[model samples]
Target: MNPAPKSWWGTPRTITETIDNRKISWLELFSDLIYVVIIHTFVENLTEHFNLFGFITFWVLFLFFFNTWTNMVLYFDLHGQNNLRNLFFALLQVVAIAITATFTGEAFAGHYTGFIWAYSFNQLIYMYLYWQTMRNDPLHATTTRPFLIAYVVGEALLIGSIWLPSLPLQQALIIISLLIFVSTVMSEHRNFDREFKQRQIPFELNSAILERYGLFTMIVLGESLAGIIEHMTAEHTHLADYTHFGLALLCIIGTWMIYYTLMDERKIEADRYWPISFFRGIHRFLIACLTLQSFFIGQTLGTGQLVYYRGLSLVTAASLLALLALTRLPRFNVQPLATWPTRWLVLGIIAILILQFAPVFVGLLLMDLILLGIGILNWTKNV
Candidate 1:
């Protein structure tokens, strides 16, 4: 009798070849479709209402939306294989993500009761997928067990929180989610280390994973731009008649310039230190910067009012500066600048600050100029 065909759901022995051959498959693209829908929902919700409290609520929901999608993608890269069963499960996840996106507006209105339930259910489905994948390969059974258990427990608590409304259940669930995240990371690292010790993995595999993660960062950045465009156009009857529209456009372009100027493709490839972990953490800050920028742009276009927080537009201007400062952290290698690319960032920040105090239109113009200057500088430096 012949043994059953090997299931195509376990981690592949050759990670490099898996990534290079595009064995990560079309799942990433499928996931991006769901993310784009979520971003559209978020921007629509923001335009309908403009208030600090509402913004904060939406911000929290956005983070959860991002975390859920990112975690699932990371797990799939580590464990998923190309096959009919895996394809079916991946499609299910995409559907679940679409359902979760539908709730963003209500979720932002502090009507998290139903949103949380939907999100928790979505998580449960992904968790089941992970469990099924592990069941097909005993080698992964021990490593994935803790993550599976934690996710189930976390989802249970999260679902329970929906019923309590005012009992700080959201906060509790958030904590549990973090715990589950940590456990999952720990389990993967352990498996990776063991594989390395046994000489079963190669450096190229890890590099490919990091590179793929970087591509996801680009997705988030692109989605943020889409949100900015949608919010600006929807709020104004004749968007082309408003100066704010141009400002929003410039800001979006400037953001892309800043990121691309400093994070050139070659630099991304050359980095050798725990590339996946480092990129994952840094991308969170990048997304935060982009999200806040969208909020500020939406506010300006909708209200034509510029309120200052610590001498900058509460959300728009300040968030941009904050994002710049964040990018300067050692992890991003903006400190102790030995390269010309790094020096341009320092100069760009100073220029941006000076523009912040000018008239709104002038400030935006200056921001664009600075971005152009940085791009030119990066080009000259051979970045």
Candidate 2:
């Protein structure tokens, strides 16, 4: 097979040649910094409101941003080159996201027109990138087609939403567009194995793409740290303040320990299609849960209400569910540990569910202990 055409700009790397050797690019890392800002804005908005409606809106916006990130990461992983054209594309994405961030704080305040338009522009950029990929990389047309159509239609819906008279109607339109895009992504990944096999390409784990996922997760984890810092800087201090701080820190560290351990042994089971999508979908849920955990932690420290306490319990419980779901994926090399981590994670989940009715600190402390136990058990088993 001939290499894809090259220009003054770099040639798109073929999976056949580069999949085994691809490395994350500096430009990709830099673009990810912009997302840190984007996520912080959304998290700040939720912190300010701290209500049911705010929680729902936060996740919706998060899903929208996450969908955009997934598509961009896929494009860069599959076809992106370190060339002038790709740099230009990355800059456009950053600018669009920055503009979107400016409006995100006010998105729920009847000032969402800018956010919608800027986000639509971001999708427009993606549509162009996918169209270019489809033309240049004919071998992956099946994979790129769903993304191209989704971006076109999704952006159209978002652009149309700017004209709606009611805020709820506009929000509904935005959600519809997100649903269309997300469903397309999940559907394509579900068919990933069959599609790649039809093209006579054996599926393998793309380490560069996996690094992108890990990097994004790590960036979002910073939200938890940010909350901890916010709590530490309070003017007045008490023993309870210090206790909440320690629990929150332990929760963050525990989550980090579990995620990276699982990720260290991660593999791609290309024979099955559902697990491919399932893995990505679960990471999405996990990232969202971590952000929610940050919010609940800070609220529990400041307000200390039944609602905030319960929110902390529930969010931490949901994070465990995400972890448990990840363990079930066949991608992990579980034979070495004798399946100890999976069993412990389930016990942790059950314990959290029961303790959620207790104080938030009880659930948080239990989570830290469970995660620590998993780590200790893994270490002993390996020894």
CA shift at 188, candidate 2, in angstroms? 4.0
True-structure RMSD, every candidate: 5.2, 2.7
Off by over 4 Å in 2: 1-8, 14-17, 189-194, 331-338, 379-383
Candidate 1 local lDDT, 90-208, one digit each (tens): 78878877877777777666666767777877787767766765675555664457767777777777677666656456756655665565446444655555544454444222434
lDDT of 1 at 206: 42
Q: Please report, in order, the local distance difference test score of every candidate based on alpha carbons.
A: 0.58, 0.74
lDDT of 2 by residue, 1-383 (tens): 34355556775565444444668889889989988887777777987776777877888888888888887887787767657788888889988877877887777454678888788888889788777766766766777776677767877888898898998898898889888878886667745666677766655446777788788878877877887777689734678878878877887787787777766645554565555676778878988887787777777766767687677677777887787776565563232234567778777778766776776677678767876777666555545
For candidate 2, the TM-score is 0.90
Model 1 residue 380 distance off true place after TM-score fit, in angstroms = 3.7
Instruction: After superposing candidate 1 on the true structure, give the runs of residues whose Cα lies further than 4 Å from its correct spot.
Output: 1-24, 165-244, 266-275, 308-338, 353-355
Residue 107 lDDT in model 1? 69
